[model samples]
Target: MRLFIAEKPSLGRAIAEVLPKPLKKGEGFVTAANGDTVSWCIGHLLELQAPEAYNPAFKKWSHEHLPIIPEKWLLTPKRNTSKQLGVLRSLVKQASSLVHAGDPDREGQLLVDELINFLGVKGDKKAAVQRCLINDLNPAAVSQAVANLRRNQDFIPLSTSALARSRADWLYGINLTRAYTLQGQQVGYKGVLSVGRVQTPVLGLVVRRDLAIAAFVSHPFYEVWAQLATATGERFKAKWQPSAACQPYLDEQGRNLSRALADNVARRISGQTGTVSRLQREHKKQSAALPYSLSTLQIDASKAFGLSAQQTLDICQELYEKYQLITYPRSDCRFLPTEHHSQAATVVAAIEHNLGQLNGQAIATLPLNLQQKSRAWNDTKVSAHHAIIPTLKRHSGLSKAQGQVYGLVSRNYLIQFMAPYEFASTEVEVSIAAGSFIAKAIEPKVEGWKQLFPKRSAKAGDPAEDADQLLPNLTKGQLLSSLQADLLEKATSAPKPYSDATLLAAMTGIGAHVSDPAVRKILKDTDGLGTEATRAGIIELLFKRGFLLRQGKSIVATDTGRIFITALPDVATTPDMTAQWEAQLTAIAEGRGQYQALMDPLTEQLQAMTLASRSVVPTQLKGLGTAKVFGKKKRARKKTSA
Candidate 1:
């Protein structure tokens, strides 16, 4: 019997549908017509063994054991999942051949791979394991993936990376959480000061932002503005163009920032006729943006539909699995595989058909613009999965959320074929005796992809101060009779709180925050704290753990969260630590490093960190804490006791 194990139930069924006909369904697995078995794990059928599993003494929290490092790893079958696990074990016993049909990513590979290893932990050598990486559940993609299966051993490095990450997370979380929980308990605070590799860094992000927003003081500034009319009575608005020598008024970046300077300039320019000193015109074109990576999709969904990251992920998953309208949703890459261009026409046709039924006038009329090869089609840029795009299967009856997300994916794909947005830009520099002012206008030549998402009004998606305005043709020597100037007072505003849109963006390119150039480059090459597949869940976990609160659409750290960061060691505070570890994970995946490479440094860091933490005085969590033992006991032994 040949056995196939999937990471999830849906994938198992999908695999079953493609293998053979007359499949027999069992309680936990399916028997294909060819006598092969297709089974699935409901996520992981096992979890890491708790501290108590190693030794009974270690179970009890104590300062005596600062850093808990398990010499031998362990796994216990998860509660409520034993039934399916038993079925897998039974299938494993009789199977002459095995297939690991897990998800294409490291986590998925590790889940089934670990299960097979655990089954053999009792010295039962099994058949050679083959890996099946199925990106799409469609019959063609599934068939191709199954036919091109690689030996399971080929993915050992990937599984190694995953295991290293899991172990390090355990080492960091278990040791630090227990250490801090004990410390906080000594300080009279009661709670599990839970810490995690990804969770801590994410919480630190929100905490840092909350602090910055709180500390920010708004400063008043001003800019001089003028409304000018051409000889033909054509009107336009201009702003005082700060010169290179513009003192105190100019910022380090040469931005106008002084109110007094601005007021003087405005007062001097008032009622004075000024000629157009320079009229610069240029024709420019902007290509359409690439399709959605999970991060970009989440950002757009948050900004346009006000959907949370989790909500967007859920919606996109359904769109991919249930409706079959989209491809994989948890992709990190915004670029399509270079070879996928061959399937572009079919996908476009499917999209047009589907949109024709929904709203033909708006979406169906989209031109077939998939021919242009943009930077977003590079094979080198494609990662585990390509960008989220419409699939060839375009069935209807999707939920409202599905429709909104699908439309975004389809529009992005279709726009690649359309012409680039073309415009003619004109800048008029008007010079008076006191200062120079500038007026700018952009005349649209071709809407390109923007035609699909037309602006509703003149100030669409723009601030009023920098809104697009129409400009009349004017010569360099032309003078305006109607000249008026005004001083506009603006405040240097505080940094806005992070919305879901902004937070996801921050998490995606988090490597940018690193001061160390070498480390930052490594971080840049990888996702920051969590995988794209897991970031949404991490954020949700933070909320459940009382680390964050949602204020409207903005996410803010709670008081407990803030205190936790202050109370925790530096190891648990910054994104850089997580980023550095992720860089190692990346290395492991690329076969450049080994599991011990990560575990060694991780273990050493934990040991040194825990011992150092033991010496420091924990900050009292006032009001939330009671007066209690804040230090290692200082009581002298009674002489009579001996």
Candidate 2:
């Protein structure tokens, strides 16, 4: 009998429902009409055993067991999941063929691969292995996945990549956590001290930002603003010319030269006709944003709905796993390949039916543009699923917040296929007594995808107005009969605090400082620091560890976070470290790099880091109730005779 292994119970049940008749469900296996037995794993039924699991002596935490480097890592069934493993093991023993139906991602691949390895299945002598690749849990997708099953060997590289990452994280987490916790206890602290590869770097980002804020010395600077009236009696604000060069006159020595400067410039051309020195205009079109990947969705939700990253992820997960109205939601790729176009249309149709009259018209007008593709959007790069898009099932009974998030994902999917927003821009240059000033305007000819979202009020000095412009009748040398002007002073402002939206963007390493075109391209391709599935968890972990605290939308580092970052060596606290590791891992996946070659250095580096951290002392808290210093402190001296 053929044995089928699915990633989870829910997915397995879904697949079983779609199989041919004569399928019968058993303890943990379902028998197909052809005598194939299908079973599923509960995520990861087995994991790398902890250090203490290897030897009884290692059970007690101590600094003496500083770097517990295992010569050969061993896997054992997780206690809670042993029963599920037992069922699978029994089926494997009787089966002549095997099919892997894990989630179509690295972690998913590793889950089944590890189970098979632990069960002592090897080579062709073991049941012939095939992989079921389904992006959605619907019956049609499931049938297609089973019909087009791939050889297991085709995904060995992917599974290897996943295994390498898992083992590396395990080694780092176990060794560092034990070493740090034991050291803390030795210093008289009782709290659990934890460290992780992703969590540590994320914590470092918050701490670094906090340090920058603390070290910032505010500098006062000024700008001169003047209000001017055109011949048509329209008022607008104009700034002094040579804005950057005039800084000295405005801010130097705190000297006031307002009257002197105004008089000197006012006499130059008070009555002279302002010339349109430059009248450059161009028509531009911007395509709609690609569909939602988990990270992208989290970013937009945080920006548009004020939801935290974790909150957004939780909502998406619920929508995908429970509601079943969306595909796997934790993907990074944004584009669906041509093969998926037909299925995508079905999903859109379902969305139209669900929206009723609210957004039915907009949904009905979606144009399929699968032929055009962006470098950022592609099929080959898709790991787990083809970005998060609405499922072929009509959604209902959603909470208000779920509806809002669903709207975002659905709209993004439809908009990506629509035409780009087209607009015409106009620029007018005017020369006044003060200096040459430029006025710009825009006229949007087609709303296109922007129509999907509600229009918002334009902010002051916004450049969006330049997108759609129809200038009033005017010539190069138009003279003005009368003019009015007002001068106002504005102060330079400090950098703004990080909102959840901005923090996610920063953590993803998409900052303005990433100026190189190639590096920026790489960052875009890689989806920044961590995978979408993992980024929110990393943020949540930071919060749980007392490394960061959220103040409304802003994230602030705790004192402990700052001290921890400062205590660690510089290598532990930078995005570059992750980027470097990713580069090597990618190379390994592409067959250009070896797994052991990459891991050997990492293992050594971790060991060195553990040793170095041992010599460093942890900081202590004082004078706080029940928060005593970790290390011994000098007692207060008794009163001395005078």
Candidate 3:
């Protein structure tokens, strides 16, 4: 018999629907008419064995066992899914041919492959196993994937990379957590001081920001503005641009720090005639942002609906798996596969159908040019999955949250088929008595895709102060009269606390926060601190561990969180180490790096860190108080028939 081992049951069902008819369903599998069986794992059927599995003494957390490195790694069946493992083992023994159907990413590759290896599928049997990558659960997409199976052996590098990352996380988190918890215990703290490779650095970011905010001092700055009238009787205001002579009176940021200098500039510019030294006008066009990657989607959802990152991911998962409204949700790629261009009309139709009467207007009435291909269509930029987009399946009766998220995805996709937003800009520089005053304005030429979005309210300190203003036509060398002059006093504001939206944006663009150029480049290329699939979970985990708290819309570090970060070594608190590890992991996935090449150095580092962890002063952990315990809520069991 030929068998297909899928990553999850929904996927197995997706595959089964495309096979021969007369399907027979079993407890944990489905058999097609052609004698092809499909079985699935409930996530991972196996996980890395605990330290106690390596040695009995390792179970006790003590200073003597600080750096517990296993000579050989081992895997054991997960207790919750052991029954599914047995079911698959029986099917593996009966099947003559195997197809590995897993999600099209690193973790997905390892979960199913590890099961195959644990089931003792080796020698010729393993060599012949086929690999199927499914990023879309639509029957048409799944059918195409099934017919184009590749050799599972071709993905060994990917699986190896995932294994290396898993082991690395295990070693780093397990050892550091134990060591820190021991240190905290010695300091009379009653809770576990958990630490993670990614989680610690993230917590460190919040703590440092809080400290900076508290220590920041506000200072007053001065600016001089002159009200001018054009020859055509048009009035406008232009701020004075300090000349080189004022350098001695300015601050490091070039702000006018002297009220006397500001007063002199305002007085000189008042009731004076000036020539228009420069007049500049230009036309500009901007395309709509590309479709949503998981991180981008999370950031937008947080900003628009106040949804947390995890909540957005959960809603997207349902939209992908249960409702079949969208493609894979955990994608890091924002570009679409070129082949997907052909399906644009179908996807648009589905979106129209799903959105009918939901919005007051008919979606079909919108000028959606199906033939307009934007830069978003690029095969080279697509990763394991394309952008999160609506599929050609229409349904209604979605919850309000689902509708909100789905609308966002659909609008982004539809706008790609529209023209770029176009505008005309004007800038005028007036010269009067040793001071330069400038005014700028922007005029909308075409609304284009921007019409689909609602108008945003003006925010404080918006950089585009003249975005909505229109300047009067004025030519160079034209004389204008200064009507009035004013000196404005402003105080520099402290950095605002991170809102959910800004925090996710920070996490995605963390490279800007790092000082080292090499590490910054690596992080920028690697898409920051964590993968799209895990970033939401990492942020949520920080909150669960009492390291982060929410005040209104802002996320702040708790007292315990601040102390924990302050107590850690710089290596543990910074993003540099994690960025390097990610770059190495990428190399491993591309067949350019070896697992041992990365792990060997990490082991040595851990040994040093573990020894140094012992010297952490117990007083540093004082006043942390008792930590809150978080556990999974158990599901109520279904009563079985006797």
Candidate 4:
């Protein structure tokens, strides 16, 4: 009998549904008519054994056991899912052939592969195992995936990369946490001084940002605007562009620091005749945004719906697993496989059905050219899983949050089949009394896909675009009258505190924060901080550990958090190490680097850090009030009728 072991029950059921008819359901598996069996793991049936499992003496958290690097890694069944592991073990022994069905990512690859190894499916049996990568749970998608199963051995490198990352996190976190917790205990702090590869750097981001904001000194900057009018009496305002001679009076950011310089320029330009020095018009087209990667979705959800990262992830998971409305919730890639382009019409139709009449009407009315291929449809950009997009399956009665997330996914997918937003951009530069001023205007040519999202605010570019009015058509050297000069004073504002949206964005695009160009490129190439599946959990972990707190819409570092970051070394609190590690992990995943190459130096680094941690005093931890405990709030019971 051929046994199919899926990553989870929902996926197992998805696989079983596509098999032969007359399915017989058992306690933990389903059997098809052709004597094929399908069983599944509950997420991860096993996890890496803890340090104490290696040796009893290591159970006590002490400096003496500082760098407890496991010479031989071991796995133990997670207690909650131990019974399922047992069932799989029995099934594995009875099966003549095995199929490994896991999510097509590093962690998912390791999840089922570990189970196969732990259950003693060895030698030829393990070598003969096949891998089925299922990203979408729809019957059609699952059937397609099952028909394309490849040898499981091909993914050993991917599994090895995940294993290295897991063990590295364990070695780094366990050793540092123990060493630091001991250091904190020396200073009479009662809380656990947790340190993690990803969490600490994340906390460091917030703490550093908070510190920068606190230290910022606000100063006034002056600007000179020329209010000019054409011969036809159409008027527009243009900002004064400081000449090279004005450098002495300007700040480093090119802001006019001297009010005298600003006032002089304003007075000189007012009511003066100025020649239109330059006029340029260009046609521009903005394509629809690519589909949602989990990070981008979380970022948008945080901004639009006030949902936290974890909340967005949970909602997407439901949309993927429960409703079967989205392809996958944990994708890093934002581009779809080109082959998926053929399903555009069906997916759009499904989206319309799920949207219902009231909302569906708008989607139906969209000029969706089903054949228009956007930059988002590229086979090469597609990774282990394609972008999170609407499936061909439809559903209704979703919760408000789920509906919002589904709408976002569906709308993004729909836009891919629509035309680009076309517009005319005109820029004017005028010279008045030796000072130059400029104005720009954007006029819509075609709403195109932008019509789907009415008046959505642009995230970047000029902040004053909304205030800009249309400029009159003029030729070069055309004379115009300067109506008036407006001298405005503005204060330089401090950096905004991290919000859910900005923080998630920071985690994903952490390369922008790095100073080293080479390292920055590496971080960008490797993605950042954590994978799409784990970033939300890492951020949530910081909050639970009292390293972060929410104030209004802003996320700030707690006193405990600030103190902890201050007490740690720069290497422990920065994203540089993460970039370096990711480079090695990616190499390992692609079979370019060996496990020992990454781990050897890592083990050596841990020893040095643990040794340094012994003499370190956690003085900053003192005087901080008790750490806030975060847990599920108990629901209030309805008052009993007397």
lDDT for each of the candidates?
0.78, 0.69, 0.86, 0.86
> Any runs in candidate 2 off by more than 4 Å, and if so which?
125-127, 186-188, 224-273, 357-384, 431-436, 460-488, 510-525, 621-642
- How large an RMSD does model 4 have? 4.8
Estimate the lDDT of model 1. 0.78
Q: Write the per-residue lDDT of candidate 1 for residues 1-642, one digit (tens) a residue.
A: 988898888889888888888999998899988999999998888878988898889878987876888889999997778999999989888887889988778888888988998887323234377889877777777777888888888888888988888888888888888877777777666556778888888788888889998998877767778877766788788888787678666665466777778877877887779888889999999998998888789889898889998899989878877776787787877888777788878887888777652223455466555677876798887756788888888686767777788888887888888788899999888888757888888889988767767375654432426556778878878887536677777767777888888888888878765578876887788887688788888787677666788999899998878888877766577777887788888889889987787788888888787777666555655446223332333321111000
| Prediction RMSDs, each to the true structure | 7.0, 7.7, 3.8, 4.8
Q: After superposition, how far is residue 559 of candidate 1 from its true place, in Å?
A: 1.1
- 434-453 per-residue lDDT for model 2 (tens digits): 36665566778888777776
Each prediction's number of clashing residue pairs: 2, 6, 0, 0
- Tens-digit lDDT track of model 4 for 1-642: 999999888899999999999999998999999999999998877767888999999989888887998878988887778889889989999999999998889988988888888888888988999999888999999999999999999999999998888888888988998999888888877678889888888899999999999999999999888888888888888889999999998888999999998989888888899999999999999989999999999998898889999899888888888878998788998998888889888998998898852233467777789988989989888867899999999787998898888888888888888888899999999999988999888889998777667475565643433444788888999999997788888889999999999999998999988899998999988979888888888888787667899999999999889988998999999999989999999999999999988899999999899999988897877765354452443221111000
Error of 3 at 217 (Å): 1.4
How well is each residue in 524-591 modelled by candidate 3, as lDDT tens digits? Answer: 88868878888888887788778899999989999889888888999999899999988899999989
TM for every model, in the order presented, reads: 0.90, 0.86, 0.96, 0.95
Better of 1 and 2 by TM-score: 1
Model 3 lDDT on a 0 to 1 scale? 0.86
